[model samples]
Target: MTTPNNTEHANIAVITGASSGLGEQFYETIAHRYPDLDEIWLIARRKERLEALAERYPNIRARVRALAFDLSAASSYDELSSMLAEEQPVVRVLINNAGFEREGLLRDMAPKDILAMIELNVMGMTMVNRVFLPYMRAGSFEVITGSVSSFAPIPWQTVYSASKAYTRFLARALHEEERKRGVNVLLMSPGNMNTEMNVQGTSTGKLGHLPYLDLKRETARTLMMAERGHATYTPMLFYKLYRLFAKLMPSALAVKVTSIENGDTHGR
Candidate 1:
């Protein structure tokens, strides 16, 4: 296994989807709190945004790295691993936070968009964990962002919910496998938040109303808790309660509710 850098294992963090929202929040929070991180790698399709975020902190700016690539492609994992090997940073943390969803009836959804959802949300997430496992094993933490939707089937956002379900299961399985290796794996399931992903009009009408959502800052805190080896983290208290309620509803009924909740938005 590639060992972490000289810094303590508790600090370094690599976050995907770092150009926006919850991922950005995690990056900023850790950069401010963990000065010992030898390096922080921000991966996303948006290179310009990642660069801008890096510029904000002189210390992080010095050690921060960014990779702009479409992770939906399987080849991206190999390329990312190559880059990491070249840099040889002791990567103590890895965040699999990039994902997308399609909004519509399964039959009406664009074929390409559905494929893209699977590619990014499920395949890409698996690839990220696989490519980074060696580096992480040499470190202390790993976190995968799942969703509350993973608990039950979601109708209009069918494939997306399935994708998150895969991610959640993957995290749990990986955590069990890596416990002895000293790497802690956390699966973070946040209720809706105010992000472009859930914006009013762009796509995927899976946005939870503001009164019931957890902001990005709280999502970041939940991620931190998971980094400490918590099995799962639900950022919103109501979301946690909602999950409990969801468990009581029939799976079929729950799916209908989700379809209604997400009917208005389109795919990303």
Candidate 2:
């Protein structure tokens, strides 16, 4: 695979899961907003898709490096590290945007998909964050894609929501720790999006009509929030209130309510 040219001292943004969905949006956001960036490395399991995405940025595609590797696979981490060793790109932003969820009861969902949700969302994401921290420096930015479901128990999406809760808390704490070093971390917990992931998964009956925010709008909002150093950036006032309501409920009660409200979505 050919690496971007003159990458040794390039100001680069590393974005995972860039083959589609919100990951693609994040790629576009960075490319358009930071045209002066020396390079943007797009990582995903699909080389074809990554190539297609690169085509969209004709003016900068040559500077946009594409690496096809699955984030859920541990060996892929070694691949990334090796590339860093070879290219030594000066990383400016790291976007851990690769993750998935299934729409079904825990027992009914395919075991592999269920396990993959955990691996990619929680385990892999954490490891990715740690592996790259040493490369990040002051003025560097990071965004971890989370969800409103993180604020409460979301039945049917039980494991998915739980994983995001881990992301949300982890990002908040990481933000505090990395801030002293001048790195800004933002946990983007936006509501429903009209992306393939949400359209296919996210079995939230109560949130079926979740105000899917515009991709570009939310992307810009997220960056603005990060620039201002907001650690937990939840879009929409409605979700902010929803989070508060969930926090006010008893833990057991929240679970029970979640099961009753969204657990029945697989039927639809």
Candidate 3:
């Protein structure tokens, strides 16, 4: 937790779930985007992957600290808090991106899977923000990864959609609250991507047929939007339209449409 080179303070960016997917994309892009950062903290459960990532990108100007953390576990937060207390770095950016989804009927999903989704996607994200907010000063940016599914309840991915809804609401509220203090909070709601967590290549559902977003492009755009102080950024024209539709349609109808589109109804 001690500052590198015995420096009294270090300006840093912290990204959770940095082992892969959007989180990894953010880590890859942030160094070039935020050149002032003295260090980048990569947090994930896999220790070897974090280390490999750190070594893979050797030319990054900012020092990389790969700290393996299972955000779903309470002890991870305690250790992170203690490290922050010891280092007291100025947090330049905080990306709360550690989350997963269990795509199945709510009743069929394992109890552990459902609970883990809520714990990481909802509780873990909230705790990460709370733990880091104090260290983020004026001009800092906080990006929370939400999803287009958050706009309405999706039958197959019930818990994930609900959790993202919480994320959207929380980030929007925090945007207003943090803006007064000059900290920008952005809610990034993106559609499906072909990431390790969500592989679209082996899909049979209508949701799978939808165009997959360019992860790199979306990641860069999200950082840009965050810098511009946007409260929310939903990528792709299709998803933007979907968001509008969800807002205009009745709740029950919206849910029904989503379930049908996701191919969860199966003509039922």
Candidate 4:
């Protein structure tokens, strides 16, 4: 009895880390897929970049909102919740993709960045779902961005791998928990996407280059898998093989192999 233009038909998609890389790709690519969407909420700390994303996709202007938000900052959640409550737009897609990582031994890493990795990757992701989970009804999709490092612990990037591992577990558990509610939760874990997070930075002794997937291609694959209700998606044959090897191989050996790739010979 519900018509296409009914008030209940309006829904929105929330994508974090929308400023650049895979997040930006999601902001662009996933909008058209949600035909029932009233708006797509772009959340990132950089307001300028979010605005730029809107400009790049001029056709979706009326359905796009740039919200300056820092996932690591716990206070942002209350404001987001208040706004969502006021707007009352049903969230059809929630992408908890805002995350950061510094590649190096834990001891040498900056304490602030380390804390932020946990805050955004683990705590922030959990809280984002908390605020929006109540609205995830029969058809809602929750996509959490994870990494190949999530399969197991890597020697150098200890904290980051651990955080993503936590995220992967959370996604898998939520997939089961929400199945009965008809809500779908999926974790999209990609390897070496050449993103700022993957490459870290030029200053660090990171690899000058590593085989990385195309951002747009991977993002499309992720969205496709999420639509299929896949609980955990590892795109790219290379990444899928890598994840398989990591899981089947011994933990210590996997860490050593990962350390070599990280350009960290002297594992801490």
Candidate No. with top lDDT = 3
By lDDT, is 1 or 3 better? 3
Q: In model 4, where is the ten-residue run with the lowest total lDDT?
A: 1-10
Write one digit per residue (lDDT tens) for candidate 2, span 35-83: 7788888988889989888778787633887888878888888877777
TM-score of each: 0.87, 0.89, 0.93, 0.88
Clashing pairs in 4: none
C-alpha lDDT values of all predictions: 0.74, 0.79, 0.85, 0.78
The alpha-carbon lDDT assigned to residue 188 of candidate 3 equals 95
Top TM-score hit: 3
Instruction: List, residue by residue over 1-268, the lDDT tens digit for candidate 3.
Output: 2322334589999999899988889898897787777999999999999999888767777899999888999888889888888888888899989987777788887898888889999999899988898888888998999989899988887888899899999999999999998999999998877776567676667776777889888889998999899999999999999999999999999887888333432100
lDDT pick, better of 3 and 4: 3
What's the candidate order when arranged by decreasing TM-score?
3, 2, 4, 1
Q: Write the per-residue lDDT of candidate 4 for residues 1-268, one digit (tens) a residue.
A: 1112224544789899888888888877887666657788899999997887877766653378899988889899888887766656667888888888767778888898789888988999898888887766778888899888888787777888899899988989999998897889999987666655454434234343445678777778777888788898887887788898988999988877776334532110
> Of the pair 2 and 3, which is ahead by TM-score?
3
Writing each residue's lDDT as its tens digit, candidate 1 over 132-205 gives 77666534788888988798897777888899999989999988888877788888887665666566334333
lDDT of 3 at 138: 82
Tell me how far the alpha carbon of residue 87 in candidate 3 is from the true structure, in angstroms, after superposition.
0.2
Native-referenced Cα lDDT, model 4 = 0.78
* Model 2 ranges with Cα > 4 A deviation: 1-8, 200-204, 260-268
TM-score: model 2 vs. ground truth: 0.89
